[model samples]
Target: MSAATSRPRLVVGITGASGAIYGVRLLDRARALGVETHLVVTSAGVLNVHHEMGLGRAELEARADHHHSPGEVGACIASGSFSTEAMVIAPCSMKTLAAVAHGFGDNLLSRAADVTLKERRRLVLMVRETPFNLAHLRNMVAATEMGAIVFPPLPAFYHRPQSIDELVDETVERVLQISGIGQASPKAWAGL
Candidate 1:
């Protein structure tokens, strides 16, 4: 069956990274496209949303089709058999990135990510830290070697984004495009 005939399920993990809006916008796009989303957020993720996006917990949770607690290790998405198309940790904190790299699943978000990797499913981690130390670089390499896509939400200036929202939407669109679920809002380059 085609994608339209079957509902695509995506597990979204939001961490204590600086770009909480990336996660929120991903949810909005997924919802708009009729995709099923399972959301899990670390405590710091919620705090980041309040600080960065000025959104409350209820408001953030309201965007997703389902919400899973970070501490809820037994959540359905934590199992390999749950069958999600992809798991994206938008604005993934370095702490969580390290955990996933070292095979540490101390919470629901990491556990779900671990399950995604072990299941050979697409696991996209938008690691959101800069000025990388050797350790951070190594962790990113390790995660990549283990099948997780270490995507940093870098702004593409070629899009000539007029506002922060445009930048965010383009980044979210690019990430979701990996799962064939969202539109590419940025103008494409026809030739180099």
Candidate 2:
């Protein structure tokens, strides 16, 4: 089915950052919401996912409607003509952020992100790094200036989340909402 007729398409990129669960949960949640997903995982991303979640590449790729190799620079997503609502790099590594910040389309993931930005589509970078150094902060600023939302998956205590799943789900829900594909019942912060 065509994306417009059936479901909105979202490009998901998973980098080598520590929080692999964010990317995985994003795929699952987007599917539940009937959104078509195009996944691209870097090699380091695959390794980290396996190390963190014990999920192999095939297992992880199975969560999405379509998956692309990082080296597939000629993939449909690499072009601006490809219609996609938005692209989110969940757990975006510092290296990936630098590439996107500098307009370096070294691979499919960064290339797709560049396309997303040039097309004026939403490109959310869920950067996962602690102890932000100068370069990391600068790259984030550069990406933000270029219309990429640099989102860090920090837990919110306002929701009083009881479990890790709840925390992750809440964060993913926020991301979906930000990407303009929000769920029917999104959790809102009712001021205390």
Candidate 3:
């Protein structure tokens, strides 16, 4: 919990993946839920956000409570003593996944993930790639064995989502709940 507001601190990482919207939406939903978010967006992540959502770095960073550069290895989130509740890499790219899986702390994002894992905190990776190859599968298995949750952001049809926004919101809600962050109104399954 954050010392200032006593709110749960969540570390969010955005990579150069296809579904940049997931990261942005997650930040928005977390903020609405009163979660303190520390954002780390890679250069490619910024480019993808601009291309997919037309959001500049400033606009994207504005959605979070704290923003850290990818190169800032000395950021607060890089240390387990910083006391983050969890870390989520929304739309986690194959490259970033590999880095985390291999324990490579080359950038602030990966370093924060390493810290989260070392602290035994929840580390959720919303891997975005489809039709994964053998290498991707191995990395995912390794990360899972190392206690990271691999969430692929697959849309649930049981909720009967009417629009893309609904689907995204539901997925973000699930992510929040999985990260131990409270969901405002979770859509629970009711058997017919």
On lDDT, the candidate that comes out on top is: 3
Query: Which regions in candidate 1 have their CA more than 4 angstroms from the true location?
Result: 1-5, 182-186
| TM-score for each of the candidates | 0.94, 0.96, 0.97
Q: Write the per-residue lDDT of candidate 3 for residues 20-136, one digit (tens) a residue.
A: 999999999999889899999999999999999999999999999999999999999988779878999998999999999999999999999999999999999999998999999
Compare candidates 2 and 3 on TM-score and give the better one: 3
- Candidate 2 residue lDDT tens string, 1-192: 234556888999999999999999999999999999999999999999999999999999999999999999999999988888899999899999999999999899999999999999999999999899999999999999999999999878887899999999999988988987855255888986
Order the numbered candidates by TM-score, best leading: 3, 2, 1
Shift of residue 56 alpha carbon in model 2, Å: 0.4
Assess the local accuracy of residue 136 in candidate 1 as a C-alpha lDDT between 0 and 100: 95
The stretch of ten residues in a row with the least summed lDDT in candidate 2 is 1-10
Give the CA lDDT, 0 to 100, for residue 172 in model 2: 92
- Global lDDT of each candidate: 0.89, 0.93, 0.94
RMSD of each: 2.1, 1.5, 1.0
* TM-score winner between candidates 1 and 2: 2
Q: Which ten residues in a row have the lowest lDDT in candidate 1?
A: 179-188
